[model samples]
Target: MGLWDKIKDGLTTDKGEVAEDAQSQADNAAAKAKEAQDKADAAKKDAGQPDAPAAPAPPAPEAPEAPQARPADEHKPKRKPHREYTVVSGDTLSEIGARFGVDWHDIARINDIPNPDLIYPGQVFKIPNK
Candidate 1:
């Protein structure tokens, strides 16, 4: 029946019988969990949603994958050398940094922009070497 009742029965019954019953219950639980997971995966695929733990599609080979141990952005790769980005209206240095995978302060140092907030449209920013 229930887990508690099963446990009680297990405690009072022969060791072999209790072990057999417990094994059966565990197998049934495993089967149920597998069925539920399969259904969820099917629903996600039907709705055009990718599996959370799986890559949506294989990405470019040169780009490195996120390491399992570290997730901090600081560990992300730096921007390639000599790349130039033009400042657009409403663009902030922080936004630019995120796009190029570099630190905002690094961009400021390379461009010598006294205030990262003070960039004007059509101004060019350089992405320095890693």
Candidate 2:
């Protein structure tokens, strides 16, 4: 069978059928993978190419450095994050913005609401963090 047909058959098969012989299935999968790898190596050898090197392990990610101390008076506004807020009855963009310490225009811009004054209940908006 073609690869796609095999994939479709696998997907359409009943779960009970798959669970019947799990160990044998796993062994078959490993054998198939090893056979495919062997075929690829043989093809490369036939083309007069040297055997490919084993893949190297990925480098570990560096740990983040600690933040330096800042002056108490240095009050630079950090870039605020956003949180999703669902609109409720009697809620307006201005009131929502006021409650969240964000500008009404910013709320409208972020959410791409066509009409700033036409928000309905259950509509979700990304409210910027204070």
Candidate 3:
């Protein structure tokens, strides 16, 4: 069985093991983020030293852009909103998409899945709006 299959098994057979795995992942992610932040802060601080030329202040976060104009369809009904799905044993993107009448690629794009082969059980992915 593959790593995904092992993860699926972990979800049902060993909840504590799955929780530990999740905690490890979360810790790794947090460490990476902190390291990146430290590097950025160091670079910024070094730039403003008396010997170096003054660095420009970082730009503020941009506000969300206004939605582009679309042709109004007052008569047509809106499609159903998207939903979230937790992956389970024997689940695949194609299978889930087929269940929801959505394309597997679309589901991957919605969840930003770089490698479709790497989905783990218990991972909650947001389905796109139809």
TM-score of each candidate? 0.37, 0.39, 0.38
Q: Tell me the alpha-carbon RMSD of every candidate.
A: 18.2, 15.6, 26.5
Q: Model 3 misses residue 113 by how many Å?
A: 0.3
Per-residue lDDT of candidate 1, residues 77-126 (tens digit)? 86566699999999999999998898999999989999877899999999
Per residue, candidate 2 scores C-alpha lDDT tens digits across 1-130 of 8999999987897878768778778999999987888887899999999876545478899989999999886797656488899999999999999998999999999899889989999999999776
> Alpha-carbon error at 29 in model 2, in Å?
51
Off by over 4 Å in 3: 1-81
Candidate ranking under TM-score, highest first, comes to 2, 3, 1
Clash pairs (backbone) in predicted model 1: none
Indicate the residue-level lDDT of 2 in model 1: 98
lDDT of 3 at 4: 98
Per-residue CA lDDT of model 3 for 1-130, tens digit only, reads 9999988877775678779999999999999977876777778778883333335578999999999887789558877567899999889899999998899999999789999988999999888767
Give stretches of model 1 more than 4 Å off: 1-80
Model 3 residue 122 CA deviation (Å) reads 0.3
Superposed model 2: Cα runs more than 4 Å off: 1-80
lDDT rank, highest first? 2, 1, 3
Question: Which pairs clash inside model 2?
Answer: none
